[model samples]
Target chain A: MMDPQRLKYTREHEWVGLESPGVALIGITDYAQDQLGDVVYLALPEPGGRVVRLQKFGEVESVKSVSDLFSPVNGEVLAVNQALRDHPELVNQDPLGEGWLLRVRLANATELNTLMSKAEYERFLHREGG
Target chain B: MPELLRTSLYDAHKKLGAKMVDFHGWEMPLHYPAGILAEHRAVRNACGLFDVSHMGRIALRGQGAAALLDLLFTGEIDDLPLGKARYGFLCNEKGGIIDDVVVLSLAPQAFLLVCNAASWDRALGWVQQWSPRFEPVEIVPGREETAMIALQGPAAAERLETLAPGLSTSLPPFAVTSEVVAGLLVTVARTGYTGEDGFEFILGAKEGPDLWRALLKEGAAPCGLGARDTLRLEAGFRLHGQDMDEDTTPLEAALGRFVRMEKVFVGVEALREQKRAGLSRRLVGFTLEGHDIPRAGYAVRAEGQEIGRVTSGTFSPTLQRGIGLAYAPPRHAEPGTRIIVDIRGRDAPGKVVALPFYRRKQGESSLASL
Candidate 1:
């Protein structure tokens, strides 16, 4: 089991709000990365691109499958984690912190309510069997 | 929860803390503790051993077996001398590949066919239906008492020699010989899925654990299905069920070369029809021009039009670039033709190229290199 107290999360297993306001961190959760296994490449949206909630903003390709990274909230992508370009395994190594996929400029604080709480996300993971 | 089939090496895999996943009903390890890239590189640089007991092994024996197989299979088995192996496909009534298999001729009227694990049932049924017409055939299902291990890499021959000296020197490509190695009777063959020099051993199930341990001790790193997939992909080997199926014909999948039109098989007529009609889609290899790794089911688009879908894709550890196999329109199937792979709603530029993405290093004496 991964640490549930490190960051807030979404029902889709993406973590949010690990950084200051206007520069909200976005990444897949530890449970999400573990399930994917041995990530090989990432297809993040270009910086300054607008993303809508629940829409696919990027992709994570592993040896087994390709997973779409859905946006948890409406925002503009400020930056994509460049470290993942060469070392996609980082997403599997540190899902919440150094492995963060993007920094988003938050458009609305209310969007956070749609995301699952830490405990709720944990239950979500449990139900999904991730 | 979905059920996963377990091989005899399940416990051995779990002991290594392998990341297990269901692959064609078998609970196989996708990778071990070190990770896919490291394990993949290990295979390219040194030897990596894999447990491939999940692959189906059927022993075909009896008078008229050779004639029956000659009529049923796509490749000519009559010419394959005893102890040699021939790669062929079991075609359906319409010339579509039922399953790709390797037929090992043990003797004139006896053979052993190895096929994809998932296609075992279909392959067995096809043999049973066709066997009675020409010869006496015995269909042995769940013959899981045998374990197959593949030792693959450039250094495979050298490392394998330490365990069983002269094993590689005596065995030619696609030929097998039975021997008592490590006090166990093992059939070692110079064959592999990876486009590397290697050997595959078929031994008793009870002796597998000891052999696996001995290989590891001898410096062959334990590689799982993950590295195996990447290596085979680089080698341009097709995976049944994914790359070709009952609905997919050999011609469409680029396996037409394996199908001998001169001989009559179950699907000869249909294959003739398809050949006359021409294929709408053709399997092609392409290199990802960017950071994206085009994965299976991802759409292949050219000039904003969906042309095809990827069958297999991975970041090649040897090339350090993304490459994949896909079936596309003939216009885009030609090598050097540019296209794009729609990776989760994003179009990543790519170009069709000749396969295999990686070539096996040739020795100075090999005629192909010269």
Candidate 2:
């Protein structure tokens, strides 16, 4: 888990970290990575592609099953983790730091307020009976 | 859902941090904390042990035992050499496979059978349906005393050699022998589903946990059904329910070599007739065009029209690619034929290839891949 005060999350379990003035770094939370054991492939959106809030942006395929990745807030894709194309295990090894999936420039910064904080996301997972 | 049945190793699996899942109404370990990919590598590169107690084990011993097995199974069980094992199928009268079984000739007029856990009940019912004709044959459907375990990989023989010296030298590959392992009398068979050379052991359930622990201490990695499925798939082994059902014949399933028309057995006539008439569709192995994974129930397309469906598929840990098995027309079954896998509305291009995406090299620990 990262520092509680700086990170924001979505109901779908993605985490967003403010990297610069309007840029954000995003990746799935630790809970998501554990639920999906052994990530194998990722079909990520291309750079400069516009993404809408709470909409499907890409897919993450594991050995067990495939899951849809939802954008936590509206943004334009700046970059994807190219290393993940060959080494998806990084997601399971470090979901918060090196395993970051995307670099997106924020479309609406207020959308971050709509997301859950670190403490709230933990409570949500607890309430889901996981 | 009804409560799932637990094996005797339920506690041991929990202690090892196994991810439990339902397999044919029984709770079994799908994978341990190491995950499926790592476990698969362990079996390919070294020794891996698996608890297969959920599989059905049936024994028959009497004057009528050979006669009983001869009429029910499709292979020549009576003439199966002593201390040898034969792979064959139990089929319905229409040549539909009921179960693929391993027949072990224990003694004169005595034999043992191991079958898939999913099809055991049906196999037992088939046995009961015919055993009455072969009177005086004792059938043991629930052999509560024996626990089954599979020790697979190249280093498998070395691990067992530590338990019983001269054990590997005495028995040939695909052969069986009885030896006391760690003070427990056990039957060890040089047979496994993985492409690697390995052994499957049958021992008393009471002492199973102790032996499991002993092997773990001997550096054998504990594996689960997740790796087992991938290993079998990589080796081009057919799954009972997934690959073939009562509606699919042996020839259509590409298991023609296992069928013996010279001998008398159930469904021999249909198989012979089909052999003469030729097959309508055949089981074929293939690899995906890219990293895309193909799953069961996905439509197989050729010439832009649906032809068949994928039976079993997975990301090959050994080959590092997507591979699958399907039934398609014989023309499309040939190698180098173009095909498409309709994966969730997106047509992923692929081609028909040979079975066994992976093979073990001679005297090598690693797998030889395409």
Candidate 3:
């Protein structure tokens, strides 16, 4: 439940952390993992693959159903969380820390301003009745 | 929107924080706060209770009851002893399965038929349409007034004994008995859909919540349909609409034992013709090599050619592996044959294995009796 004030959020329940200039670390939000239940498998995008904002970049499969992982920012994948291959439950136990999905070199840093802050995202969730 | 029906224990499920979902037209619990995995493990290791009130219960009375049931079901109905239950299928004239049901012989000319929830109305109609053939019979549908609950697992008998004295010892497998629990009359049948030793209670709808609370007080974990599906799949039990349907025969569904061929029934001629002509496709159990979950409607292939399709698939909590049932061509249906299940878009390697991916140890006497 790491609702870091600095991290940006999306309506689709993804989070983007500005790791460095023009680079970002992205993972599904704590709310997303809580809704998905125990994650059994993760299909991640390979490094050097292009990812478009608001598009499906990967998938998270629970025992009940599969949910698409939407990208929050346009970028090229620099690295994926390889450790998730052996232990998918990391997404459920530590979704914000060890469960980060990808590190991407951003295509447009200006897009970060359009994403919601922690307070705004919390309000959005409230508005949506979640 | 049409109104959704709720079971008598609906408020109890909500109080327990169960994740509710629409099952057919009934609002039911898909899983509880402990989740599907824990619920599944509880049933396999200890005991679990389920609200199965949505399933249809029909009561037949009068002298024509036995004859009517005999002509409708595939099994021998006339010879069933009192206080015993038998599992069988209702098939159409084309030998296709209509529904799989359990018939409990309550008395000399009285019986109870339990059917799947989704097929309740259709099954009732089928029985009603054929009732004229055996006149002077009373067909009473009991969905509105009755509720059903199942207590299943290896420890089910022990847990049940705490509530009803002499129930575990006196009631053998497939036996039914009437008892008074908490001042409410209940019909306890030693039968279950899950491949475990358990009892299904048919009681008044008004008394369902109290019984549910009583069972929980006796240390039975509350389970949902999520665990129910996986448990039944692990036991190699066929789901009516998935494994067999209006177009699939009992032989193709690997349920030949339940069908008594010597009897004259609705679909006897068609089944006899199928036996003479040989089955084109057969249902087979399979196991994946890894964690890739094979799901229903996945394409099954052999030697790079599509041979069949998966009917039911799930990650078995007991086995800790992916297991499924598929309908394959006769050549590809034998055990030990290698096959590929197209999961999502990737080809997952698997092997055709024997039915029942899980079996209780010998001398366990509970599930082994099934």
Top-scoring candidate (TM-score): 2
> Which regions of candidate 3 fall more than 4 Å away from where they truly are?
A4-6, A19-23, A46-52, A76-87, A93-99, A103-107, A118-130, B362-370
Name the top DockQ candidate.
2
lDDT by residue (B45-94, candidate 3, tens digit) is: 89999999999888999888899999999988878999988889899999
CAPRI grade, predicted model 1: medium
Provide the DockQ value for model 2.
0.69
Per-residue alpha-carbon lDDT of candidate 3 for residues A7-115, written as tens digits (9 for 90 to 100): 9999999999888899989998888887877677888889999999999998887777678889999999999999899888788778887889999999999999999
Indicate the DockQ of the complex predicted as candidate 1.
0.54
Docking class of 3: acceptable
Docking class of 2: medium
lDDT of 1 by residue, B1-370 (tens): 5777777788888998898888888889888987777888888888898999999988887876887788878887767788887787998887778899888777668788889998988898888888777756665654478888888888888887777888788876777778766667888777788877777888888788888888888898888998999998988888999888998888898877778887887898898888898888999999987677877889988878888888999888787778999988888789998898887667789899997788876742111121
Off by over 4 Å in 1: A1-6, A17-24, A45-57, A70-80, A103-123, B1-3, B272-280, B302-306, B329-331, B363-370
lDDT string for model 2 (A1-130, tens) is 3454698999899999888888998899999998888888888999989888889998888877778999998999999989998889999888998788999999988878889988899999999976
Report every candidate's CA lDDT: 0.82, 0.86, 0.88
Pitting candidate 1 against candidate 3, the one with the higher lDDT is 3
Better of 2 and 3 by TM-score: 2
